[model samples]
Target: MSHVNAALTPRARLKIGRLIVEQGWSVARAAERFDVSWPTANRWAQRYRECGPAGMTDRSSRPHHQPTKTPQPTVRKIVHLRWKQRLGPVAIADKVGVAASTVHAVLTRCRLNRLSHVDRATGEPIRRYEHDHPGSMLHVDVKKLGNVPDGGGWRYVGRQQGNKNRSDTSGKAGNSHHNPKMGTAFVHTVIDDCSRVAYAEIHDDETALTAVAVLRNAVAWFAARGVTTERVLSDNGSCYKSHLWRDTCAELGIVHKRTRPYRPQTNGKIERFHRTLAQGWAFRRFYNSETVRRKALPAWLHEYNHHRPHTAIGKIPPISRLTNVPGQYN
Candidate 1:
């Protein structure tokens, strides 16, 4: 009698082969019906007759051996070196006598990329602090300095509010507004928050256009000195809030911050600086003319940065407190 040839497991194949031979089915017929080749059917038939189902069972697919796999000891060394030295994968590989690529593999297995480490002080892995870096912010403002006389009269530029072209012959003539002869000049100044380096420009009018041009020049000046501005803070004035000023900030990628209205203390750093400039430079002593006062600004600025001592900065120059080198172990 004829039976069906089925696709079967190894043991079933052996049994099926025996049944096929008992029924005397042709090899080609068994092959076509069982979806197997004639050689496989023939081999199964031989295995069943000689060794039975035990010999027909399938063997494992894994290879018996490999040639050059990395040793476990080397892998352990790589892990130890990476943790102990905090070294990069390439450095760790060099220390452990392995290929750089091998080091990368071990690091990947251990989840130890160089970027994975974090700073304990700031809790930031990649970002830096504003105080730790230069070019974080720029401070700008207009300072009203006392007048200096020239050619037997105070050199006047704009509307001399209380004093403009006066000869204070009296030894006690110190107040410029009561003198009625001295004229004040407004000095527009910009200082880098990171370096405390300052730039001052004398102007009769603090208009929006003047302020914009001064800022542009100040930006270039600071750029030359390795100081750049990521942001700028200023008082809330018509000049700063002008459309042109807003456009300039946008074009220059400067985030602008304005002090609260009527709150001069918000920008007290520059305001205090203005008072210091009036007391220390412009009004420190009597000058012959506005030309003399104007000419002396550069020298005063230099002294302010390099020579003068600042109480806020531990009796050091303003520049010293602003800029610091990184990784200063001492």
Candidate 2:
């Protein structure tokens, strides 16, 4: 295929060559007719004489030989350091006795520029896979965020004021005079593997009962959008391992799968979604109180499901995957 900036396509170059060679037209005249330079016209004509139509196609822009290229052994060393030691370009360069730029270039060629793209156990590129259909699998996890104190936290308010607010909110409970601190908000999340459609809810606890309820609701939410929950993947958290969660999954007919211990990448989808949730909703703006922040979740969730572009799903909103969903356009 011709490049975007190319003056002549393969077919046009062939015609120009025919005009100059077969028809005995002057090189300058063929160049003028084709709106190309005389040298361009003459080059194509010569190529036709030597190699015929195949030579009309674009040639490789790469040089035939690169004398200054790094040696293969040095490149292997850089890749080994990256995979085995998990070193950056500079570190690999220092160990391999090459310039950092050369190390970077070699790593880029080997697709190891980003450490996240390489597996920690092996130096190979991480193999990415997705389910064939929506609801074939769901990734579930909980992101624990510090509850915002009343009158805002240290993020927007000064540290002194934030501390005062925290102290003021830490009230004594019952007969005991011990002050209870403002606890965490557990953001329960469930995301479809294929479509990346996500459902989340903010709760005060990460108990097994809460996890079961959240999963049930998430399944219903997906069902409303024409996606049936077939399986659920989660970390080996206490809530996920509870009998309640097991019974609920059995009742819902969903196979409950758990990630290997200390291996978060096994359930990477929900883990990544938590990062997005924190950036786009939990900490996107300052709230005067926890109540205000809690109220903001539904609106952001709606935007995420129906409007926000998901990179995993072709930069379209997650709702686009559910064709049978009603009022999806709306």
Candidate 3:
């Protein structure tokens, strides 16, 4: 492994060694000439005498002795349990009579700590892809948020006093309370790849028709700002796969793209947007009512698009990268 701290290459090391040996330069002189430490120059000269050119190459820094290390058989057993049974470190430790930390260390050293690193049946690395242009790809997703109680809920009050707050808001919180099931609002979002500009709207449901409507609005939003919607990326949800969704893409001349099953990161940009949306808008304030919170969405989005700096696109506002749209946000 080439390390950033390695000041000299193998070739340089060999040349210095030769200068000290073949050219008969002193260790101190060779060290001074090469701008290396005397100890390093001396070590190189000694290594060259013992092993010649091959010794000049990079060598593993692993210690020769590891007396208290886990035995090979134990490691093999642990690996087998992890790969075969798909057991976690704690379970593996319980089965193998080792500490959980020990099992974790073994797994990490074997490069098997993350299950995503390899396929269970066949150990193959997962491949990731990225697109270079902003408008070249877009990710669409829907996030569900529960309707807040009339005033505020448990987040404002303590968890223990949450029921009291709900009772105060809903007028005796019980099975008989109106809409006791707790209705949900779906937030449909579209995010660009390069600039990460996002447009979102809340809806009653995430049906195919609703998704299409959101997509059309999002596409238009991006278009107004100078991003062309060339590709639509989403998860394999029913709404995304429906003919309604496909036909909408056809009408818009967008290449409808679906992530591989169980791979949400394939549409990672919008997924990350949902997380930001939750942190920044949904949970950022104590709203008197759901209507107040809903009303605040546009302001937060305006800030995110026109003011908040995004680290991915060089720590500037997403709108800063806009080429299609000119003039500043009023």
Model 1 residue pairs with clashes: 149-288, 149-289, 150-289, 163-182, 164-181, 164-182, 165-181, 166-181
Comparing candidate 1 with candidate 3, which one achieves the higher TM-score? 3
Which of 2 and 3 is ahead in TM-score? 2
RMSD of each: 24.9, 3.6, 6.7
Worst 10 residues of 2 by lDDT: 171-180
Off by over 4 Å in 2: 1-12, 28-38, 120-123, 170-180, 324-330
User: Model 3 — TM-score against the truth?
Assistant: 0.63
lDDT tens per residue, model 2, 243-304: 99999999999999888999888888888888889899888998988889999999998899
The per-model lDDT (C-alpha) reads: 0.70, 0.87, 0.83
Q: Output the better candidate (1/3) by lDDT.
A: 3
Winning candidate number (lDDT):
2
Query: How would you encode candidate 3's per-residue C-alpha lDDT over 1-330 as one tens digit per residue?
Result: 346678678888899989988999999999999898999999999999889988998788899999999999999999988877778999999999999999999999988899977554444444545566667888888899987766676788666565554556643334754424446789998888877787889998999999999999988888776667799889988999999999999999999888888867667678879999999999998986778989999999999999999987778898776753335322
Query: Candidate 3, which segments miss by more than 4 Å at Cα?
Result: 1-86, 90-103, 114-126, 159-182, 207-209, 236-243, 259-268, 302-330
TM-score for predicted model 2 compared with the true structure:
0.87
